[model samples]
Target: MKRSKALKVETMFNNFKLTFFLQPLHGLPETLSDTANANWPWQQDINWFLALAEFKRLTQQPTLHFFLLEVWSEHTRCLALPLCSTKDGRYWSSLTDVYSPSFNIISSTTLIIANPWQCLLHALTQLQPNWVYCQLSPLRQEQIQQLTKLNGCLRTHVFEHSENWLANCSSNQEYWHKRPGQLKNTIKRKRAKLLSSGSRIEIHSQLTDELMLKYWQVYQQSWKQPETDRYFINWLANYSAANGMLRLGLLFIDEQPVACQLWLVHHSKAAIYKLAQDQAFDNLSPGTVLMADMVNYVIDIDKVTSIDFLTGNDNYKAMWMDFNFKLYGAELFNINSLTGRWLWSKQWLKTTLKTIARQMHHLIFRARHDN
Candidate 1:
């Protein structure tokens, strides 16, 4: 089957058996309840925000087919499956499988009689695409393996877990107050110096669209390059505003906006959505100051349960959260087929090479730093 240029949601919905139940989860509803759609820091609903950004990104590619799979239930909230397919290249799909036993059951059953490992398996069987790609949390490795064994029609790839740090303000003051000793002291001194020097920091619970747009402009200036998903900024600005999820924290040095961060607040947790800081204020550690202020504000003022430093596997995340959630991605294929066996061998070779290269790079960097 040839990939279609124009992807109609209705057509995609009609092609699948579970479409009627899953469509609403993808933001197809005429109206969504606050309870159902309320933003949660680490919950799957936040992916709704991520998916829209992804969808808008793919829409820019005039030749690609974009399809979104949304799933919902009273028991579990909304989940989105954003997929992009191109005739000449690989098909890409966002991970929609929630981390739960029920999801594992459904996925396992589907693979028993299906060619592929996911709901997209049905679509792939019908469409016969070159490849179908999906991202899964690292914690779901067991489930992925199970599906691959059942279907014998997929390959698995693994990637780093996007780290998130959480601290409950109401219960654990120590966690909220704690930070890396050196970094914490440096930021504390900076904050004290700035306060004594008459600088002020302001935290806003809600942001106006105009102010959010200003932050995006600052982001563009900071990067100084166009990203593949240019529409992401606009989507975030609008979605946060529409859903009352926007939290803008600004660090002003003598009444000038030197640093700013966009955060999402939901279900007693706050997530660091995006950040922008002026290059000139780098010496003052404006970004660090802003983060400190947010930690305190969420704990003392907003009384949020936790805050997530999403996506960066940085050293800072390790210091903040004792435990981290691992994100896993894999390719599943039939081990019995010659093509599948060949693909697996090639992937294993590539992974081995990359691992060796990474270790070599780390050693070289460490030696240089020690010198």
Candidate 2:
């Protein structure tokens, strides 16, 4: 069946005589609320915040199809997947927006399906999303294996691998002892030097709109690029204030803000949202000092079980994180669609050219070194 570009796409899929409902975020199954609240973090509220923030962009001014799926089967709701289909029905993909790093498949504890991958594949067919792709960071070996054997009708590709860092903290003393001795001493030394110079350091945990503006002001002084999502951040700040989920940390030096971080606390987990440090205070290591203090607060005061540094595995993150996980990208294409077939061919050709170019570069470098 072909879809008209103007009509809204909503339907149900069937496999093994069981129907699976594919609905938008608003049409989630009644049982999902308890499951989501128990299994996921505050960030998973992507339905309300992230989706809303990107709705207009994804829809292309009301000319495209955009929906985050909440899939339900006969007995129970299995998972929620992010999906975006273009107006022409020619382009469709898994949602991997800039703001969210992990397009994770959150499952309910009630899931009892024998072959989840097969069921998911059948459900996906109903949407006719020509191409479905997502980056699964830190996926388990078993999950990747299941995805590989999803179905013979679809071609699946595992594109890349990356890493994410996370810190597991139980207490202040434990966290302090886990870090390298050199790091501990350096932070202490910096703190002492700043104090001796009459510079005071303060931590701000609550973020009112007024305080967020102060953070934005200090962020402007930082070395990072101009924030493209200030509006989104402001929206998040407002949501967080009413819910009491915000943990905005600012390192002030004698009444001037130098470094800041925004963390969202949900139950026992705290995820770092955004952080910035003034380049002028680089020598003072305001960012590092601020991080150390925040770590202490997260562990000692908040008593959170874990702190996810989120998507990146930078040198600084490695220094602080006790462990790391791998991230992978997967793309699945439907063989039935002519557009899908054409896109797959173009993708293969592009990949081939890149591979050949890399090989040529390697050979040239080798020859130059020999000469």
lDDT of each: 0.54, 0.64
* lDDT of candidate 1 over 239-320, digit per residue (tens): 5656766678877776667778878776677777777887776777777888877777776766677777655567766665
lDDT by residue (tens digit), candidate 2, 111-194:
556666666656666554554332333344566777778766666666655666888878878777788988988899988876
The candidate that achieves the highest TM-score relative to the unseen native structure: 2
lDDT of 1 at 38: 37
Off by over 4 Å in 2: 1-36, 39-43, 46-64, 74-76, 129-143, 201-205, 345-371
Off by over 4 Å in 1: 1-62, 69-80, 88-90, 95-123, 126-150, 168-172, 220-230, 334-341, 348-371
Looking at candidate 2, what is the lDDT of residue 254?
71
Q: TM-scores, in order shown?
A: 0.68, 0.79
